[model samples]
Target: MIRRKDTRRMAKRPTKPTKSVEPRRAGRGPSPEKTAQTRRVIIDAALGEFLENGYADTTMDGVARRAGVAKGTSYRYFPAKEALFEAVVREKIAGALIDADPANRRPDEPVSTFIRRTMLVSIREIERNGRAAIARLVLVEGARFPEMTEIYRRAMFEPLLKQIRDLAATARARGELRRPELEDYPHLLIAPIWFAIIHNGLLDRAHPLDIGDLFEAHLDLVFDA
Candidate 1:
């Protein structure tokens, strides 16, 4: 489901290590949540700068101005341009990861229900979050920023891949899913969802894709033989 970089924003690292370095230890000040929020705001503004002025053209100063923060504040969050880029990409991808987790679901629910709920959450995340812009950037501009792609593949896409893999394994174990190509079923089921989301952006248009119908049809096609 990766896109050409020209069309979307590049993916970010899924987590930030440096952000965990407490400012209190560094003799700098702010509540942890405040620091996190400020970091997010800076990353958002930096993304805007990168988009408006291509990555090559964007600068820390521009990002600072766009963020309405002092240049020093921007530097505090992302000392290097590469770091800033990574932070921004991670910020977006982490949101997707959060959406994919199904801990909110009831414990007694069926696996199918859990999967359906997770997929619906994912659909909502893709629709409402800034995924379109990020996906397009990754496809088009990502080649120039290899780090971004690496972050995306490892952090963002890999988790989703693992989730599908686990779902397939669970279904097979439960006798609810049987396919000569069992492993591939997960890919077949999930790929279209990702592609549909990406294609929506590429075409510069939006339309609702039915997650429930798509999931059920795939399950029926693969497992109902």
Candidate 2:
């Protein structure tokens, strides 16, 4: 009787498996997030190197060392020195555009105040850091690397110029300013700022007029009559 009971068949049952775990967060390692961070690091390092050493003198090995990356890894990211240099210049110019925020264009802000704030920031960046060198690099190598120059002109300079001209037009409409016809004299308007920036390192160079005061004075000169 016991042997016959053991021969009885059992009903089939479904088995429930345990839940699968997620992959661990890779903090600043070689994962996607880390790769993006590493790429930024390489770009920043290359920028500093190019600013200090100029494009011709900047090398992949030097940038790799500065970024704490292997040459192979740097090459994997940038492929070549020209590519890296273009990226570095583009990054710097892009940063300027982001900082400018021309679209947030406060047409209501006093033109003098606007010009002061904008020019002061520009002058500080151009003088405090080796930004002049960055600018020079872009201009000189831009012909050779059209991409970098195009990014500089289109993204950084053009937007600001358009914003300024637009703001001037608005101010003129409001009778707040006599049009200097600034659209026709972008360089003349911008030159004082650049001249100050360029001669910042020189001793006994006739300092360009106090930019903050001068911009306001210029505004008054335009609006008064």
| Tens digits of lDDT, candidate 2, 119-217 | 546655554455666666676677876766776676566776776676566666767676566645555455555554445434334654454444455
Task: Score every model by TM-score.
Answer: 0.70, 0.66
Model 1 segments more than 4 A misplaced: 1-28, 50-57, 102-108, 180-185, 203-225
Report the lDDT of model 1 for residue 215: 53
Window of ten residues with lowest summed lDDT in model 2: 196-205
Number of the top-ranking candidate, with TM-score as the measure: 1
Best by lDDT: 1
The C-alpha local distance difference test score for the whole of candidate 2 amounts to 0.67
lDDT of each: 0.69, 0.67
**True-structure Cα RMSD, model 2:** 7.2
> Going through the candidates in order, what is the number of backbone clashes in each?
17, 0
Q: For candidate 1, lDDT tens digit of each residue in 73-174?
A: 989878898888777666764565564564544656655667666665665555456665566676777798887688777766777777767666766766
